[model samples]
Every structure is written in structure tokens, then in C-alpha cells.
Target: MSDARAPASVEVEGLTFHYPGAEDPALREVAFRVRPGERLGLLGPNGAGKSTMMRIACGYLPVPRRRGTKVRVAGLDVATQSLAVREQVGYLPEQVPLYQELRVREHLEFRAAVKRVRRRARRAEVERVAGLAGLEDMLETPIGRLSRGYRQRVGIADALLGSPPLVVLDEPTVGLDPNQVQGIRTMLKNLGGAQTLIFSSHILAEVEALCDRIIILSRGAVVADETVSAALASDTLSIEWGRPSSGGGGEGDAIRGAAVQACLEQAWSRFDAAGPLEVELSVVGDRVQATVVSGPVALDELAAAIGAESLAAGLPLVRLEPGRRRLEERFAVVTGFREAPERAKGGRS
Candidate 1:
């Protein structure tokens, strides 16, 4: 990577920080880089130092006593050019502090001025960002009167004031309706190419959707830094298949269910014969549900084989489709967090 001219937009080496009266350090030798145009998601359970790292990156917290450890933002030393580093970053905190008395337009205009936007183009810039954040309609409305969703938009608008290349957003979509979440996601995706974004979220779905890469933290250290595809590569491909008959007879339903079960058993037997294998199959409704835990197989292949074998026995192929991967299951397996049966886990997703 030496000849690569440091693809990193932000770099940190040997970063460690401790809080007053804390038994352990909040960050310990945390080292990672945010490459130019990379949308990196920081993910962790509660109290995993994700927020601490964000604070350090935003210059809200100071480095430890050891000096010259090396932290840089936009090629400026975070230790020395602290003010310059702050000037180049746009930070959206989790609480989203804003003056409730100010109108949406007034709040954005005030932030732009604080960021030293030029007098001639400040209004135009404010309007452009307001539109970008979908705040155009509420520009004249008081912030306190806006909904939680609109308040979030105003916070995002404030962060974009100086046209900073690096944007750090914390829990940008915590309490929004589906439509509001969609709007925020669309805006972030639109900004992906022009800005280097580092967002932290406890919601796995959000990270999977918005981030090109993810850095999962556990116990105040980096546990995983990989693309979503890489993180979920070992997931099982669930298959469901059923046979249809001329009429909806009870016998036909039973036969279809039995055939699907037989197909799954046969597949598992085949896999076992090929190698040491572990799999699971069961009946769900009129179809058979199967999960092959060991090796990866394509959904089409599993469905096609089952369909062909069923049709050879004079049964009509009814339905065949792939099931979505359960992110919680994959997380448990990868992170070694053994969970009870999903239904038994308080029935909360």
C-alpha cells in the first residue's frame, strides 16, 4: 500500500483514549483509515466505543498523554492542525442540538455563516442544501414544531454547510417512519461519490443498505472490517418447494408436503455422502423448508433439483422460491453470540 499514495482520507495510528475515573480505556490502539469516496459504517452493540471513536474523529475529545501517535484528517495533522481538521469535517451528533426558536432556514443560514461560507453565495448554498435534505417545504417552519424526521433533515443540512468532503453521521435514521428512512437513505446514496461518509448505527439493516464497507467493533476494538457480502458469504440459502395437483385435495397437499420433505432428506444425504455435512429440513405449510448449513449452494440449483425430481414422479410443480437471510442468525454465528430460538427471544426483532 506504500506506492498507493495513501488512499486514506483519514488515518489514525496507535489511537488510544481514556476517560476520567474509567477503569479501562475507551479506545485502545484503534487503527483504521477511511479511504477517499468510501462510505464506511461503524457498527457495534451498545457501549462498544463506536461513539467514542466518532468523538475522537470529530475533535470533540483529546488524545491521550502520549504524543506523535499520528492522526490526520484531509492530510492535516489532527494533533497539530486541530482547527483545520475541524473545518474540513461535518459532524452530526446523535442528540442533534439545534435552537428551537430558529426557523429551519434561519438555522441553516446561521450554520453556513459560522462555517465562513462566502457572503455572495450563502443564500444559494443554503437553498441548495435545504433542497438536498428535503427541507425545502419546512424552511420557514420553526424547528421545535417540526417532526422528528424533519428535525433530522435540519441537522443534516447544518452539517453540509461548509461543503466538507468528510461527513460523519451518528444514527441518522433512529426514529423515522419508513418513508423518512427512505428519504435519508436516498440522500446519503446520492452523496456517496462526492463525500467520504463515516456513519455509525446500531441497526444492521441500515449499515447493510447504506455502507459500502463496515467495521464492526466489539469490546472497544475492531473485530471485523469487510464488505457486507464478505461478512454474509457463509449464509445458508433456504429453499421451499411444493407440488400442485389438478384439485386442492387433502391427499394432494399431503403428498406435496411429503415429496418436499423427501427431496430435502435426499439432498442432505447426498451432501453427507460427499463430505462431512450438517443440515436441517422441516415442513412448513404445504411445502418443505430446508437449510444446508455447511456448504454454499445457489437457490436456483436447489429449487431446480427438487422440482425435477418431483415432476419425474408425475407431480405438478407448484412453487419454488428463495428465502431471505436472517441477519440475526448470521450475526450470532459470526460473533459467537448464541441466541435462543428466535420466537423465544422476547418476540422482538
Candidate 2:
């Protein structure tokens, strides 16, 4: 039985699943909760069980009767009351499924009927969702003739037919054009405070923009779970400096690198009372980049220490930035993909 006073809009406990002939479980003891009206993002590399988890949450996959998989939607146990749980959730799978032959309005109306929305209320509900998804102008267009963006919107509208409290979207903007992505992002931003949203996306910036909190999955297990603010507020200092003009040859470069390393080590030693600090130094072209990883420390203090030490070593500092660790970088580090894809100069599109 679910607790009547449960504060979460969605809850999962000890959830695990395996395919009939698979050697390992697709999901292993995954657990998390979403409070009412909270937007959460799920991130992971391929085969990380993100889609699997979303499927279970949407009741598309059933939990084994004796496996003790516990999931609830809108305070209703999903395994025990699948239909009721479905009524409280709007799910958009990675692949937007739609009836190609049907018009947008026709498809939404059909979905509303299948979801058992009252006959008299179905039209109003369809219209409301259509408006929300920006399908008002193309409501009568055949779905097959619509663009991918329009098709995604139709899928979203179909999911929203019954005003479900929890909306789960998997890769809602995958393969979308820049304009289309922005449109969907705007819609989702508006929906955040009004709906309990759980979405998964490989686009780190998209997740950062739309989610309040993020849960990162790795090898079917939760690896990193934290608020967007905290995740972005990493305790690392980034320093960029100009390399010496004479440090062109390999030997010169090695010597310069060692000097920079020594400078950082000396600066870090100033905080001997504070724990250990790790430094990673690399030379990109003629520029030197140094990253100092340590526990939470004042950015200004650390920057001052590094500046003073570099001056003593005759190393020229170009820029010092704090908390520049991006969400994608953290994701890569946690998931063991240390070489995270670099973002373009301006940022993700």
C-alpha cells in the first residue's frame, strides 16, 4: 500500500529488471523520487538503462510479481494499479509514435478515447493540449505530412491529453533543428512549475536548461545525483596562461611544464592544513591550461595563491576562472568517459 501522505509525485525503490535471456540485469536497484512539480533530468551514456527506467516508470514494462520492484505515480502503486498510474502520467518515448494517416486532431482525439477520458471532455482536453503544444495552426494537417518538429509536438500533445500530473519525456528534442529545439525548450520551461517532469537527454545543455535536478546513470546504476546549481558549482579552479616564447622544442616544453607544475604544487602547499589538491597540466598549442582539483575552497584565495607562486616562477598568467566545470564534464568524469566532448565556442546549440 502506498502512503497517503507521500510527498513525492513519483517514487521508486529497489527497482531492478532483466530481459528473459539477458546475462545481466538491464536495470539494477535504481531508485529516486520526484516531488510534485519538480523537474528532474536523467543522463547517461548509451545502454545506461535510461530508456529502460523511463519505460518502467511509464508502466510500459511490468515489474516481476515477486521481484519486489516498487514504483508509484501520483501516490498510486504502478505495479498494483497500472491503469491508475497511467492516468496520472504523460509519457513521450524517444521515438515519437503517431498514426501517420490520421490528422493531428484526429490522433489526439483517438488517444484521449483510448485513455478513457470522458466523451464530453475529450474535445476540450484535445484543444487545450493542442494549444499547449503549438499545434493550433496545424490541427487539421495529416500527421504524415507534418514536419518532424510538428510530429514531436503531436506526440507531446497526445501524452498531455488527460492533464496527467507526471510527464515523462525521453529525448524529446533529439535530432531537432535549432529552432525546433528552442521551441520545445520554451514549452518545457513553461511547463516546469506546473508539471512533474522527468526527462532524459544526451544534450547536456538541454538538461541543464530544463532540469532543476539531475540523476546520472552508469552501467545501470545511479552514479551522480545533485541539483543543477550544485553540480555547476564544482570546486575546481581553471587557469590559462601563455607559454614562454622560447619553449618551442619538446625539451623546452617539458621543462616549462615541470616549472608550471612546481608552481602549482608550491601554491597548493600553502594550504597544507587544508587537504590534498590534485593538479592536471596540459599544453594546447602555445597556451598552457592548468586545473587544480581540491575540496571546497575560496576561489579568490586560491587564485591569489596561484598568482603569487606563478609570479615567483616567472610564469605569465592570462586568465583565472572558477567553477568552470560544466555538467557534461562532470557527467563524463562520473561515467568514466574522461574525454568529454568539447562544447563549441558559444555553447551548445
Candidate 3:
């Protein structure tokens, strides 16, 4: 059991690692802390070191000698107390490794024994996990004969054997059918708050659903770390307006542009008296688009203010949407797949 006074569930400080012959380090100065019972999502594109970090957290990989590189699980230093750390964490890797010939019950029993459950309590432990993983009906089935989803369940059952305080899953629902995915997601939701969970998946929706906090990695470096709500909220407002027809009695491009600029300036002066806002206006053919970039603020209020100002300025309000970047869009920008014009212009505050 861990000391009662420990302040964190999992801690990694200045963690850096390199494969034996690789050209670059697999992880670089990674650092974060998982509060007890917090469901954290570890996100990254392929080759972003999610697997490497997971292994290190579960004490499967050795801690490098780099200064300040440390990993502690349940108040025990993973480097010095590897066995205890392993006992404190239940791990389900991306690949579900199981004995092909063993029955589901037999495999779980074997895992319980390996995890050092008392001989007399092993049966109860196996049955408990089997029920939790929805494997009670399949206990008699051979591992080799089960579908991919069932095999994954067997792996989860094994991990849950000793009721570890921390559960780390790597792509737990990678290739399951929709039903199977839903089942697994439901199981994970039930596990929330009962144990601290850290899982990695390319499915953003799944991550968003199961995790309270998110850590995004790009090329082995921690890029963005924030709560899901904050990540999804935008710090910019993008407003678009349609230019009046220029044929006979409508306003021309110059007039439309000036109207938009004046409206945006007035809105900024009213709402952003602190003067941290960057407003950009452009006339594109028959439309005018204005982007207002500022520090984190109430987006709805900003939109309302912009709408009222546009109305006062006689500008057509075609679209008044949150200009804040989406999590997916930001992920792409950070991972080097694409560039964001707002980012380049220091628009992200």
C-alpha cells in the first residue's frame, strides 16, 4: 500500500528517453502529474511517444540517468521500487497478449496468481474481474476461439485482477466493432473515479468522452495540457458579413470594408478597453471577414457585442461564430501537419 501522505497519484518530472540505436530521443523532458482518480487522456499522432511514455509510467521501461528524470507511482519511486510500482498499476497494452490455448477463466486465474493474490482469494478475484469486464459468460471459452473484442476483454479482466489504483490502457478499443466500442467505453466510464486512468487513442471523440483532462504531445514534447472544456473553447471570434449588391443602389466594396472595420473597432474599444485585442479586417470579393483575437474571455459575450455593433454600423451579419480554434485544428497545427495563419500572426492568446 502507498503512504497515506503522498500528494499525487502519478508523477513524472523531466522524463527523457532514447531507443538504443535511434537517431532521436523517443521522449524529451516530459513532465506532468496525474491527481488521484483523475481520468487523463494522453494524445499524440503516430510516433509521438505515447506508447513510450505509457511504458515508462507503468515501470516497464527503465528511467534514464538524465538529471531530474523521475517517475513515482503510488508514492514509490519506479526506478527503485519497480515491483511495487507494477503492483500499483494495471496495464493494458495496445496489443492484447494472452495465452492462446487457455480458457478465459484459466488465464485470469493465472494472472491473479502472478499478481500475488492469496491462493484462497484468487477465485473470488477472478470472478470479480470477469463480471466487471463482462466476461462471466465467456469464462469457459478458449482464448483462441474468441473474437477480437472478447480477447480485449480478457486482457482487461487480467489487468483488473488485483484492483490496482492506476489503470493504463493503450488504444483499448482500437479495432472493435461499434457495439464492442460502446461496451468498452461504458466499462471505462464506470471505472472513472474508482481508479486513475490514463489511456491513449487516435479517436478524439473517445478521448473527449472518457477523459477530464488532456495532454497532447507533438514530436515527444508536451505541447498542450488543459481541461477538455478549456481546450474546446476559442479565444478568438471570427465574424463574416455579406457585402451589399454593387449593381445599382448597394454599397461598394470600399464602403462595406469601412463599415466592418468601424464596427470591429467600436466593439473592441467597448469590450477590450485593456487594449490586448488584435482586430484584422479583409474584403474578399462580395464578403467581408473580420477576425478578433484576444485573451481568453467569454465567447458568447464577445459574439453578442460584435452582433450589436454590426447592427449599429448597418453591416449585414452573415455569420457570427466563435473564432476560437477547434481542438482537432490546433492538434494538426501543433503536430506540423499544417500551418495556422492566426498562429503565425500571434493571434492565439
Candidate 4:
């Protein structure tokens, strides 16, 4: 993934996978790289391939047989050097697998043994992870007797075994209560880049809170790969507009509704290519204002183009300011859950 002395923390290239007898591939030409010590969040709806991708990266699922696909962990190929990759990854799946009869401490010790920790050092290793997961008090309690939150902590502790270089967690906070979720999030945050972390969750807030970078998957394709700031910004621009002159000295109110929308469409049409913008129009007192948002775009160039368009049409441009889209809506546009504003007659998208 890079020329650095250490290989990428995790890497995927031209990855595509299909379940047996499935019509559509679960993942389609997906490619991304996770940097060493970075926290990456995988975000998508159900069946969006988030879990499948994680499984493939963890070596639990096989990479496609096709030649173009490659999956690697810590510079080791997952398809060929899975044993070595396993040694470098600690994985927690959507469902926690635990032996109900075993106590928390015993479960961790067994996992450490399975991970091949040295015989004499397994107990000390188990204690270390338990403390990180806040499971010291529950270490002696049988897993079946512990609360759901405690059980989740046990699963996390198990994954932390051996201090693997890459830690992959799939929906680790799915069923936990608010307090439980907060506790687990804080614990993982405290890891502080000790190991690279890749996690998935349906909760956008949780993902934004825990990850410095995020990769959004949609219908098996990589839709967005951005740092938290860039992802949320969505390159929004808010403009305050005035009515264009109607071939006379006085400004006309005719450009209030559809005319305003047409002005925008025509302005954007001037460019060779422009990202689709979600336009929202509102009237403050007697003034007409619009909030426009799009994915990454050339703000300075666009602002100039838009200004030129307004001048050409004799539409007085009152103001041109930049703003951010609502956090959740930034995702909606890319995920196809919502469409842009359809009208300017006091209508909002």
C-alpha cells in the first residue's frame, strides 16, 4: 500500500466477492487502505457489505478467486498468508461467541491460548486485557451469569488478546445501553493509536465520535473516503439573493419561485461539470436566501462562476457565504436516501 518500512496496516485492491449462487457481487471492485495506527469507520446500511469486508480483511472470509483481487493485513496477503495475518489481527464479529459455562477470566485465558500466547504468560496477558476492558471485577463471574454489557466487554477483551497490530470490530456496540456504549467507546479511544482499528456501526454519531477517518460503502462500492472534517463539511455555500432587474430600474418580484430555481440551474449549467447540489430556499423578512450543498467541489471557482451568472442575468447577489450541511444530510445525498430541493417557492429538501 505504501513504500514505508512497514506495510499498510490494512489494504484491499480491486476486491470483489459474491456469496454462493448470489446474482450480484457482495462487494464490487472495492479498494481502500488503512494507515498504521489510524481509526477507520465502515459505514453503510444493512447488506451494504460492511461486515463482509471486515470478515475478508480478518481472514474469516475468503477473497474472490479472480486475479485482480487482493486483501492484505500488515503487509501479509490474507489469501495466502492468512495464518500470519491472523497473528496480526484481533477480530470481533457482530455476534459475540463465548462459552457460557466459562468465567470471564477463563474465557480470556482460553482465547489467549488459542491465539498461541506463551503458556506461562497467558494469565498475565488475560489480566492486562481485562483491565483495559474494565472486566477485572467480572473476571471470576461465569459469562452466563454476567449482564449483557459485561459479556460484550468480555468479547472486546478477547479481541484485544495478543495486542494484534490490526483490530477489526464489527458493530461492537450494537446492543449495548447508552452507558455501556459510552464506556466501551472511551476504552477504545484510550487505545490512542497503539494499534490500527477498523470498526463498523449503523450509528452515525458513534462512528463520527470514534473514527478520525471514514469510508462509506453503498451497494458494495466505495462512495466516500474522507477525514471526519471533509466528510461532514460537504462543501456547503449559502447565498443571499435579490431579485434580478426586469429590464427596468426597479427589481421585479417575478423571480420569486420557479424563476429562482431556474437561475440556479442555469448558473450551474455554465460549467463543464459540477457536482449535484441540494438547494434549499428560504425568505428572511423580504429577502430570498438559498443554502446550496454538494460533495467536494471548487468553492472559489464556483463562487466566481455563480457571481458571473447572477451578473449576467441582472440578479443582484446580496451575499455569498460558506456553511456546512447538517451532519446526517451529508450522508443522505450520497446514500440516495434523499433528493435535493425540488422547488424555491418556500419548499425545503
Candidate 5:
């Protein structure tokens, strides 16, 4: 990093925000802190307050301070010292804000000047960021002439100017082709441990692949905050009991129900059933298969329990597999995608 200081930390306490004349606040008593050098991903469906939280963190939105409400970025109050906060925080919104007329080098030089990069070192700073974003070859290309991928790279390079302590990217890979997305993803992966990076994305795999920690927002509330490991070990699993003991009709039916009941018993023993576990069982000619959906069931522990129980019952285990990551389910559950009748939108999304 060009700045000769530790990466900046972000702190928000009891923050609530409302757009002009909005009936409900965009955010509600939301609170969290990001440590220096942490890569945090903010996740939510559309209008779930993810973007609002990002704006507040980057000092683009103002917070009305109640007794416990405030937002601090890089040790500066976002409301009181927005300019200073902006100096230390580099932000790229959902739309890549660019002047298409300018050449890449010219645009970056202007950005460096705006960020107060030293006059003598400005050229070197621009070159440094350009290299980091793999734009050294396109320095003289006019931004308007560049492909969408190159344009996104230019935006990234611009954000890296002066090596700001915190870098925020919103949907940075949106609308890119596969190769372009991979390029950007690789560049972002190389940026960790040097700066405080926070971004918002609807892509579960992207967030899972990039972030060390994740915070999920739903309906203007912070619903889940967990490390990547914990978040991905969701409660869904696929379990296969040994092939039905040479049968096809009523025998297979009885065996399927019995095996799934055993699975439920094992799941319930691990933790209290948050309502009955959702189970889908099938008895094929060869094996009895079940897909179990519950809440926060650890894969290893549950698998071990089932294996032991199945062994004692003279039933061999065919396979035990983890279903989708917990983050996806939480995303669906809180965003109301799991329900037919979704909640009405009342907040300023």
C-alpha cells in the first residue's frame, strides 16, 4: 500500500438511515465492525439494505446520530469528516463511474490528483495501480474504446490510486463474460491482507470464493454474520442408506420410511428440531436416498452420528453429501424466496 499506515477499520453502531420521504428506514439499528485487513462480504437480495450499508460505510450516505448511532471509517466520523473518510476509503459503486473520453493514463492521473497523490509521485502511482490491475498495456487507450472488461479494470485501477486504506467494490464483476469475471476475481484475490476490503454481491459463489467473513442483510436488518467455513456448512445434506435388501414393493416403502426416521432421529439428537426437519426420501431398486433439510446441522458430526447408527442397525452407508451452502439458504429464507407470499416492500430499498 502507498499509504504508510495500517489498513483502516470500519465501525458502525446502531446505525439507521432513511431516504427523503421514505416510509420505512433503509437500515435499522444495524451494527458491525470490520477489522483492519479483513475481507468482508455484504450480501442481500435487491433492496435489502446491502447497498445502503455500503454507502454509509464509504461516507456516501449520512447517518443521523441518535445516542448510540454513528459510522466511522478509517478512524474518521463519516458524518462529521466525510472528506477525510473519502480520502482513506476508495469506493466503486454498482455503476462504474468513468469519463469515456479520457485515455487510461490521463484518467488515472486525474484521479491521483483528486486523491491528493504527490505531484512528483503521481505518475509512478498511476503506473503502479495500472500494473496491479494488468492495465499497463492499455495506458494510452481511450476508455471509450476499451471493451467492458478493460473498462472494469480501469475502474479497479482508479480505485487503487494512492493505495487507500479501505477499498469498497459493489457488484464489481456484474455483466462481465466468464473470462473477464475470472480475471477480475483473480485480481481481487491478490489484493487481500494489504487493505481493508469490503464489497457487496448477489453471487454466492463469488462471495464464498473471495471473502473470509460474510454478513447477510434482510429487510433492513443484519440477519447473519459468520465466517465462510461456518456459513457454508448449512443444514442440508444428502444421505443414502444401503441398497434395499433385495426387494421392490411394500418392503422398499417400509425401509425408506424407517431410514428417514432414523435420519430425523439422528438430526434431532444433534440439536433441537426447529420445527420438524424437511425430508424428501426415495427408494430406488438399488438404494434408499434421502435429502434432509434442517437448520445449521454440522456435516461431520451429523455424518458420524448417522454412520454409527446405521452400522449398529446392520445397514451400510452408501453416501453422505453436503447440499448447498448455508449462505444460500439463509439468503433465500430471509429474502423470502422460500415462501409463496413474500413480505411487502416498505423500506427505501
Candidate 6:
């Protein structure tokens, strides 16, 4: 189920595959497009062929030699021009194979040579990549002795040896501390606007933070492909308020929600609205719990109108902030993690 619904940067058509000695095809009629300069996160549970697809993209695994079309990388035909396609793409596999005995500088040089970096600027090129990857300090350190983060950086440096337009990173941050993860994410975010990057990870949060869009694959097919903001924006709202205590709970304090709702209703009278907006409000100690539909009305205006009136009536005002119905919550809703009868929708809980 590819998103034939939108324009594509990379396109695949009628893709089918079966691994040697495997019982079934790893991929089946998979078709999707990754837009140019877009960071698309590939997500799936174990054994869903995410790695297989990445391998195909990198030319490690050959597409089935059949009459029908299959896969392509960077608009180059994978079936007929895989070699040329690979040259235009950079791949960092899960293991990040490197020569442990070689120093960081040496490993990069070796990779540069293998990638056919020109002789005239090889030295400067490795130095430049080392600086970009934050490998300057450890350039003289042996690859085997470096931490997981540093080793990953070395791998990335190698992949970026030629500054290819497309870079595929397979779980580049699989095992690293929080700081290291943030560092990598920051680096990638800084690099995103200039180059197209495709990264695979099981961590949805990482995808949420780094990728502009996400694609969830299940059973070798795309189940979701949407902009990261669109995905998160669907179920969340941005709310603003001041400290409740400052509003001075007046006589009308008890009817704050009702009053606010009424004010919104009055303001919305110009147009035939969609019934009432869905909102979840609660109070835990001093913090107000709110889940309101995001709209054009600025928080300052809503807060001023509601808070001023509420304060005059004896309620508190507080600052406003954006709130999210977390990614896991959205995932559960879409995937039906919890099941109930149709009547469940009618019962308020």
C-alpha cells in the first residue's frame, strides 16, 4: 500500500522478491516514492524486510531478474544500472563494518580509496570529513578502541566520503547514550536541508524528531507515509494559559469551562460549525489538563478573553503551551491496540 496519492522523489513499481532458500518473497508488489531532499524514516517490526529493502537500495541484494519492473534508487533504474546508482548513493549498514586495527584516519583513507576519491585531494577530503563527523580528536585512535558513538561517526564519515546526494543509514544510533543520540540527531538535522537522507529505525521518537516524514512498513508493504508534523498534528492541540491562582477565583470560578465553552460558541456563531469541538479537560494540583482542537485563534487572545472574564468571576489564568496526544497514543488508535464493541464509541469514559 504505497502512497500513490502523492508525488515521489524515488519511485518503485511492481516490486516482488524471494530470497534464495527462503520460503516466500521478502517483498511483494511494493510500490512507493521517496521525495528528493526528504528524510524518510523506514519503520517496522523485526523480520519485516526493512533491511532487505535497504540492501536492495544499496545494490547488495539483486532485484529479481524478471520482465516486470521492481526497484530504483535516486531515479536510476536499479535493475539495469545498479552500479551507477550505487555510485550516486551512500550506504551505512547496521554493523558498520570497519577495520578495528586501523586508526580512524587510516580507515577513512582506505574507504576514500575504495570509493575512488581523487588522489589530488584525498588527504584534505579525509580531514574535512573527519571534522564534519567530530572525529578530529580520535583520528589517531584505533577503530576497535573507539566507543560505539565514535565508531558510528567513523562509519558515517566513510559513507560521506564522496558527499553523495543520497545517504542511507541503517540504525546508525542503535546503541548509544542519550547525549550521543542527541548529537547524532543534531548533526543530521543540520545536514538535512542540503542532502536527502534515508534512515531506518525502530524508535518512533527518533523518527519523529529527525525525519520530515515517516513511512511505516508492515509485511514488506507501506502502511503509513505522511509528514511527521502532519502525523503528530492530527491528534494534538496548542494551548496557552496563565497560573490559575493569579486569576483570583471569583464567584464564577466554578463555571470556567462552561463559560469558556460558551464564549467560543458565541465567537463561532458566524459560521455553521461542526457541532462542538472535542476536548478533554482535567486538573491535577495546579496544572490544568486540556485537550482542545487546534485552531487559528492565538493563545493570547483565547487566554485574554477567557482568563480576564474568568478572573473577574474568580478563576485563575495560566500560560499556554502546545500539547500532544503522544505518538504511542496515536499509534494505538490507528492500529487498534485496544478493541471494543461498536457501542463503545457511544459510551463516554
For model 2, where is the 10-residue window of minimal lDDT? 340-349
- How do the predictions measure up, each by TM-score? 0.75, 0.75, 0.77, 0.74, 0.78, 0.78
lDDT of 4 by residue, 1-349 (tens): 1111232388899999999999998999999999888889998878889999999998899887788888988889999987878878888998999999999888899899898888888898899889888788998999999887788788899998888888888888866789878888997776647888899888888877888899988899998888877876646578887654442222434346445667677766665665555577765555668766544557766677668877776667899876654546756767788875342323333
lDDT of 6 by residue, 142-209 (tens): 99999888898898888778777678889978776787788778877775756678888877888888
Model 6 segments beyond 4 Å from truth?
Answer: 1-9, 66-68, 235-251, 264-277, 283-289, 293-323, 331-349
lDDT of each: 0.71, 0.81, 0.81, 0.79, 0.79, 0.68
Candidate 1 stretches with Cα past 4 Å from truth are 1-8, 65-68, 235-275, 282-289, 295-324, 330-349
Model 3 per-residue lDDT tens digits across residues 1-349: 3212222299999998999999999998999999888889999999999999999989899988777888998888988898888988889998888999999989998988888887888898899889877788999999999988889888888877777888999988876788878888888877777788899988888887888999998889998888887777667777789855542124567777767777766766676444566766777777888777645546677778788988887777898886555568767866778886552252312
lDDT ranking of the models: 2, 3, 5, 4, 1, 6
Residue 184 C-alpha lDDT in model 6: 77
Q: Which ten residues in a row have the lowest lDDT in candidate 4?
A: 1-10
Better candidate number, 2 or 3, judged by TM-score: 3
Runs in model 3 lying further than 4 Å from the true structure: 1-8, 236-266, 271-326, 341-349
Sort every candidate by TM-score, greatest first: 5, 6, 3, 1, 2, 4
Clashing pairs in model 3, backbone N/Cα/C closer than 3 A: 234-324
Q: Clashing residue pairs in candidate 4, if any? A: none
Superior by lDDT: candidate 1 or candidate 6:
1
Tens digit of per-residue lDDT, candidate 2, span 1-349: 1111222388888988898899988888888888888889999999999999999888899965556668988878888888878767789998998999999889999999887788888888889989878889998999999988889888888877776778899888866789878888888877776778899998999988989999999989998889998778756678887876556767777788778888877887787676656666777777778777655557678889999998888888998877466787789888998864332221110
Candidate 2, residue 205: lDDT: 93
**Whole-model lDDT, candidate 6?**
0.68
lDDT of 5: 0.79
Candidate 1, residue 332: lDDT = 55
Runs in model 4 with CA error above 4 Å? Answer: 1-8, 237-322, 341-349
